[model samples]
Target: MDKVNRFIQFNDESVETRKLLLYERIAQALSNTPYMKVTERQLIEYQPKEATLAISVFWRHRTEEVTNLGRLSDIYLLSAGFYRQFDLTAWRTFTTDIKPHSYPKLARQLLMLLEEFRMMESIQKSRAGTQRAFKVRRDIYAEFHRDRLLSNAQRGFLADALINQLYLDIHIGMTSSPHDVFDRLPIDRVRQVAQRIFETETTSQSASLAFQIIALVEEFLTGDIVLPLYTFGEAFEDGKPMKQSSKAMESEEQGESDVKETIEEEFRTWHRETEEEKGMHLEFDLQHGTEGASDASDSKPGNEDAEVQSFGTGRSEGNEKEIGAQPEIEQQQDQSVEPTLQAGSDYGHAHTQVTFKVMEVANKTDTSSLSTLSAWRINHLPIVRALVTEMKKRLERKRQYKRENLTKGRLSSKLTTMLTDERPKPFYRKQAPSPELDAVFGLLVDGSASMIDKLAETKEAVVLFHDVLRELNVTHEIASYYEDTFEASKEQQPNFFEVMHSFDENRVDSGPAIMNFEAHEDNRDGFAIRWMANQLGNRPEHHKFLLVFSDGEPSAFGYDRNGIIDTAEAVWETEKRGISVVHLFLSSQQPTEDQRELFATMFGNKTASSDSVEEFASQTLRILRKLLAIAVQ
Candidate 1:
């Protein structure tokens, strides 16, 4: 009681000013309610029917966030907008004008609930035409009442009191999906909502609840989803030197929880899987703690703390060159008016980049942190983390082993005297020049009808390429092609392409064979291979190249050998613009005369036919280093 009394009496803010602030907050909340009359004239005839879809989508995200925020009641009238309904005391205050002696908890709860609901909810289901439309009406009553009462109390209910909740919802509803309600709203709503939310929220996120709420909001609002390109900067066999986290990027993502426990669990699972596969070259095994290894100085000579710091995932900030330096492809329009990355220019290979873009249900600015969240949650992060960690550990092992030998005046097989300098150099491939395409590299894979037999094998090839390309600061775009040619042009260069007979993209299992769940003539590889080559042909930079696997379907980049039909000649014209074609003919049949001629011309060697994508990809990997070296050089 004294806490509340002391807070009000000593906090010298004027009551009248607070009252005005309260009205502003109520208006903000009311603005978010569907079908609310912005002007007095609209009130007479404006039926809120159109707002139903927005309201439904908004309510969906609202439901999830409120539940997680521990403020479900605020979004739901089930227990008076709380996960756990409050007592009559909460109602008494709202139904009557008299304020309670100490309802700080109620105010706080309402603030948290409303903040979560408003921020996360945007793409609401329309109740206007449905039987349950009345429920949204009920929600408006509860939400508006709570907001109004908090304002009338002449106090800032939550730190987010000044936030424009309506704008936040509008931002969350926008998407390319015709069903999304955000298309009707102005994009300014996203910016305005983000600003208000950012302003009203605490300067620092202090609690787990705050983090969760922030994460949820981010997941719901970031306006676009830019699929990450896996780079090669981090690629190396286990036991080789490890790159510093800052070298490649704010190493792509992880959470703040028991990361070690998660890591250990992955370790165990990895070992089990490898053991099951009878790993020929690699398998996980726990190392025992060696005695006398405590302080940094006491660390084994080669396994020094500096060599392989336990990589904790972080964002693109430490010495960040650029974070997603260029804008996304979908937003690219009127390029001459608005500058964009030139064809084959540095579009995805900046070693250090920091992107400020965020993602969410509706994809607004307020939910931007979710960009990092999604990045953190990416499966590649841990897989790559473990890969990098394992690489780091092996390097440390190799280092310590060499250090011991050096003390004894001996040498290990891993080290060889370098010609450049007298210093011992590890047996590793020379680092390639940065392709310098962008702050990120995008690998758009073609998975369509013709690419069917090669699909399974291409999986590893994609991951392997992803590992190297991402490490090298490159992003990729992989999609299918069947009959129809896929195209995405960024001022006459590849941006992101996906077209399987003109149907929309659905990532994996996308072609006629995969989607129809049946068979076909299987000549789709011609169009698929041609499309990939054409996409690569648009690039002006020689450094950026395309790695494609096909069955040699008599396809030309655009035309045969030298004709305009050959996009390859155009693609290959760049300084290092090479298309190192590798085909693992996943067909049991021997290469026919035409097929042999095609494969021989495209890939240097005739088809080495296989039945699956895995074996073919692995077989292809062995030759990749040489082919890539030649291409980039």
Candidate 2:
């Protein structure tokens, strides 16, 4: 029986990815700004200043259509209703002036609801199709608010009860209060002031009218509001409301600084684009030595072919020569290190603040080692042949179909044409041979000291992967990575990647290099995965896969605590760039619950743990088959 990963989830990542991208597109379209981004939050809100649309988590349990429509309603309110119609500056001024009210919270909630009512009226008038969605919204909110009003009124929470009643009054035209004891309240005065809400056009007018209703009902609204019945999208850029004196001082000090730095706006928030535009991307050439050197401050690096250096036990004399003949600045550095600002700045949580010097080790194994090749072939020949056969079958099936009804091509014979005297439109075309997967693969093997026991199984699995892909003539790269603990520091860490086989070199004799894999000092899984992903990003393939073979989690200098978060972020970033990452855990014993959870957090469901060499090999083949299936489809 084939070994299957028990923790494997059947949910398709591709579909979820596509759905997220589609939601972003929808937000962009609705907001009429390409910069709009959609994220999940506890309540629905749209920050126009930040160009972020947040959908509520409460819609998750609803049906797909209802949930989508609910999100659309929120976006429509914030985009069309408030963003374009409401006057934010005027609203701020009104709030600043009316700071000393008996029931400030109640007054704020009343203004928010009135403004929403105004925007909803405008939205329904302009977009007739949105009326149906709003009706559904009304039906859902009405049921909840009706029950809430009764509960709050019975408990003497008059402020909360009043807001709920007001929401139901305007939303569904329900006039009666839930209880008779609450009939002594000033309902007639509140209704009279609410009548002017439709005639008011701006937010300032809405606020002025809401305060009038608040003044009459101030006696009953003695307590603070527990929860708001409605939400107005976040309009204030500053988190807190500015005091009157601070607002005046800010107005007085506008543009007072002589030194002003301006940042160009972009439609998307990609840091890589900023680097390219600012010419911060560095290019170091290793092939022609110092002759191709670029000035760190002046040269616009051209697109040139330069081989990454090799280090560790696999390092060769040629590699040393390439590493030594660099401009003094480039000798010790294997990868580009970004310059950091000395002054403190808020770089945010997503920044890893780590740099790497990637050096690729050259393969030095002699092809004359027949014993190594014979040993691997003798033990894994059947599995290799089986994988190749199954892959070729899928590839052929994907390529063998034909287009039956073409306007111009070789003539086709049809009896119906003669019997019905139809126009002789009988042409067909053979479907062109589909490209082979249109994908590129990168295999990263961990060479940490902990892998000493599992090295043999890791090699066996890698050899099987190599033999099958080589037989199918697919493009791939295989490398082993480890971090040099002695050279690690706060500024930079040296990472060595030994390439057994690269995309350009698909030699059959490279199997000896695979057998020469060694256990090194430590593993920086995040840095290694990120560096490999950067390599794969440059390839011209639609589908990219990066498979990591490791024995445990990341363990390097000062990286133990935050290594999991960094690795997970790297995986998330790679997948966003259209790369699929899978992790294979090889150990002598089964993984514990904590170990399984750690791997899940880092790789999601794209991971498999194996305790034996045979199981590891089987899991590798299973993952490859699934990936190929996705590619062929």
Which candidate number would show the highest TM-score if scored against the true structure?
A: 2
User: Over the stretch 95-206, how does candidate 1's per-residue lDDT look in tens digits?
Assistant: 2321331332232333344434432322122212221323344354346544543453244322232122332232333222211222333434333433344333321221
Report the CA-based lDDT of candidate 1 relative to the real structure: 0.31
TM-score of 1: 0.24
Tens-digit lDDT string for candidate 2 (1-633): 001133554531112323344566766676576556565567776543334666666556678887777767776776567656766565666566557877777777888888888888889999897887777777777887888888897888888888887788888774664455357677867876787886998778998888788778877655878876545423352223222234334654894422111111211222223222332123344564447556587766666686656644433446555544445445434433333221111111222333333343434455654576678778878877877777778778767876665667877876476456565556777766765667789999988888887777777788788877787677889988887788777644556677788887654546777878888888877777777888899999788899999878778777765566557766887888899999988877777766677688788899988766568878888888788777666
TM-score of 2: 0.61
Per-model clash counts, in order, read: 87, 3
Ten-residue segment with the worst summed lDDT in candidate 2? 258-267
RMSD values, in order shown: 31.3, 10.9
Which residue pairs does candidate 2 place in steric collision? 309-360, 310-360, 310-361
Listed in order, each prediction's TM-score against the native is 0.24, 0.61
